[model samples]
Target: MDLLSRGSMVSRHGLVLLLLLLIGCVYADSDDQVFLEINDHKMTTLSNMSNGSGRNEQICTLCEDFASQTLSYLQDHETQTAVISGLHQVCSKLFSLKHQCLTMVDYYVPLFFANVALIQPEEFCQKVNLCEMMASLRLPNRDGPCTICHNLVVEFLTKLKDPDLQLEIIEVLLKACGKVEDHVQECKKLVFHYGPLVMFELEKFLETTDICAAIHVCKASQGAAVAATLLADA
Candidate 1:
């Protein structure tokens, strides 16, 4: 069978197994029984995969494809629910790490989704050790004032999912804006204007807005247009 066919088969079988496991757990006598049953299921599936040559390569390909597709969907949708659902769907297709995939989805998906704006597929694959040799992608330098402002906004947005760092992040952004010597007022104004909105409706803001442009810090082909416009108006 082709990879697509194989993937679909794996996914269907995995989902069935998942259903079975859930049903079995409901009747099991103890937590240990449930845990052992899950481990046994996972080991059996993994052993089947390991029986063939190029199994490692197949697993790597599935993982890379999953990361790429998940990131693409998250970029387009920009919501936690979209990413979580995509992760679960893709995870079901994997020939190995079935249980770990579910666990990682719960623990790491939030962090990955939070930085979806900044992350690249290859970087994510590498981070999970699924594609070790791929180089990390980097964003270009934001040397212009408005670009700097936009970067700060992106930085703040990327960390919005972390409640523990919310106050510290706000302080950092404010301090960073305070130091922009050339456009100190504009920078701080953008922060003060959008800061509360970010706190209240982060996912909606991400889904529906180009925040930097909304703040007048970035424009198509004219990164410094806002500063120039302010000067011309003054």
Candidate 2:
């Protein structure tokens, strides 16, 4: 029920994410199938919280508590698809929450770090089962899909020990970095928040120190600019 916005709160952990997946189950009028189809059997809070079914509201409250309490437990162990499905059901309700919901989708999303497969380029897609449907989640009312969500999915796909999948993830994320730069604020925040990981990727995938310095420049500000220049000179 507590929905915090990102622009308002600041903590040592960085921006306080205001994402609350509290929508209960929703019952479609037999014509609605996006839930069953796109969600892949995962029930979101919106689907469960719809007023159409009196049961939806009750399920929403119960699932909300369950998600808040059990998140740590789920993260500790190997979070299977079954568990993710349940969580997705709860999170989907969040889409309809126009006000007072957290915007921290990035935090709660499951991250799967997978390795790349070393096969011929032709066989790569087949070997890894790399389909867009399985690779990314479409954001509500967005133009194209987001690499951020896909990055997490790619991480999950790598669980099969496919190195090709890992390479795909790297390429995907690098492309995402370019997109992030388009929004200066998002790029700076992403770099600062996930600097170590970004640095790791920069070192491995990109074969240059200039790119890292450029990232630092992207993160720098007025006084920070002078320091960046000094670092670049060194």
Cα RMSDs, all models: 24.0, 21.0
Best by lDDT: 1
lDDT of 1 by residue, 1-234 (tens): 011122233343333222222322322333554434443543343333233333245344534555565455555643456445655765576445455456545654554445666766555554434332111111134355354444444434444555545554454445444322344454455446455454545533443344444333456446445434432332
lDDT of 1 at 23: 27
Model 2 regions lying over 4 Å from their true place: 1-161, 181-234
Instruction: For residue 76, give model 1's deviation from the true position in Å.
Output: 15
lDDT of 2 at 39: 32
Kindly state the number of residue pairs that clash in model 1: 0
**TM-score, structure 1 vs. true:** 0.22
Q: Candidate 2: deviation at residue 202, Å?
A: 19
Q: How close to the true structure is residue 128 of candidate 1, measured as C-alpha lDDT?
A: 37
lDDT of each: 0.43, 0.29
